[model samples]
Target: MRLFSTSARLLFNNAETKQMRAQLDETLKLFKEKVSKIKSDTSVTTDKYKNIAVDLGNGNTTELKQISTIALRGNNINIVAFDPKQVKRMQTALIQKLGVSATLSPHNTQTLLVPVQTMTGERRAQQDQLMKKLYEQLRNDARDRNSISSIRQKYLQPVRKRMQKKEGESKPELKKESEAIEKLVREYQDKLTDLYKKQ
Candidate 1:
């Protein structure tokens, strides 16, 4: 009997993407058979296998027993004869296979998300700290901008008006300057709007 199925082409969708899958199947078969023999000999205990508990959201948890057979959703945890140390070795060998499986089928989303979730969580705490720091920086920047705007309105404009009066400039020059400033402001606002829309 064939130890591993040769339906890799069908599983992966593209008929050409079978090389990695074939290698994966061969490796898995060897690993599984070896583990099964060890278990049968009473030399290895089930407890030797590592249990990686994953949060399934809504207060549910899934224990990943074997590295090769990654479970998708609902009642995911299953028992396998492999030990934790061997499980790690299997993980490295099957990583590319896992990636290919995800790319071929949208149904693998939940399964793929599990490994990704694990990887992301390794740095999630650090990312949260960085995010808080960024938020504080932005808040302080906005406050400084508001302070500058208040100074311009409360102090700078009145001083400029007094200087203009002392210089004896008529309404015509003031009207031209005001119109130019308004046009520039409108142009800048339109540009900002366009940029926002693109984003």
Candidate 2:
């Protein structure tokens, strides 16, 4: 009976540890997703322009990619409207969206050409500041979500309640588990820091 009881206690502890690790892993996964979204939003890619919404001047909006085919030629984005009549409206919308950066092709009225802007000194500084702000916000969000107290409230409390209902079971080794959780959080934090530094 004594051996059986010890074995059961060990199994319960193992299960609780696994549960905590799984919760922490889920938190890490969400943080990674947010980081990826920020990187995608900041990247200068054709896909980004394809998703831009153009106001049709009638209060209705259409996605640029839906109305036109977009392709990258060298460092320029070539957008060709499928319907010739929509060309002028597309041009106006593109100009309104991209300012002077978008221009109608001289030879093709149905086509627009947008030269990709180089990261000049001013733009580079602006990008750096924006990235810095985004990185800081990500760090703050992760910190809030994975803080020790937050983890205790969301994950540890349930395990503690279960342990309390068991007869003669010693208090859960929460200090050890807390240390393990902290280590996992730090690893993810380091990964976020490295990602920011690489940007």
Candidate 3:
């Protein structure tokens, strides 16, 4: 029983050691690959970085010339440059690496002007639309006034007959009501005229 227990412990220790060694080997291999690349880069004497210009699909060029710092970690390179060009290039490279197909291009002034002209035309159309709406409102108001006057005339017929029959009827009250209605109708007509003149 003692021998069996000792053998079991040894087997467990061996397996643990093997797992740790495998992990160490993998880590060392990665480290060596990174070091090899760094050594090559150091020998290459990379150029003193200047402006980076990236042409965008929108026909715009972005340039970045100023650099602040550069850092490398393993296989990754970090460049800190405020130049727009550098940023664009790096972004493009990264996208390409990731298998993105979209490419940046330049923007054209003529293309931009096309949209501007279209917007101006749209604005003019809107203005014309507003004017037409105003004219319609004026016409509707005038029509409404005419219709009201017609209704008032129908309703006042009986009242006018009764007032005529009354010998004491002052007639001034009926005259005043008629004058008020006439004034309102005149105002509506004037509004219609103003709307027409505006065009």
Error of 1 at 101 (Å): 19
Better of 2 and 3 by TM-score: 2
lDDT of 3: 0.40
Query: How many clashes in each structure?
Result: 0, 0, 14
Q: Using TM-score as the measure, name the better of candidate 1 and candidate 2.
A: 2
Please provide, for model 3 over 37-129, each residue's C-alpha lDDT reduced to its tens digit, 9 standing for 90 to 100.
443433321222223444455776543233323333233233444544444454553344433332222341111000001224555556456
Steric clash pairs (candidate 2): none
Local distance difference test values of all predictions, in order: 0.36, 0.65, 0.40
All candidates: TM-score? 0.26, 0.58, 0.25
- Candidate 2: deviation at residue 46, Å? 2.4
* Candidate order by decreasing TM-score: 2, 1, 3
Q: For residues 109-199, could you state the per-residue lDDT of candidate 1 as single tens digits?
A: 2232222222145354554454444333322333443221222233235435834673444445445444443443344334433432332
Residue 134, model 2: Cα distance from true site in angstroms: 6.3
After superposition, candidate 1 runs with Cα above 4 Å error: 1-166
lDDT rank order = 2, 3, 1
State the RMSD for candidate 2.
5.6
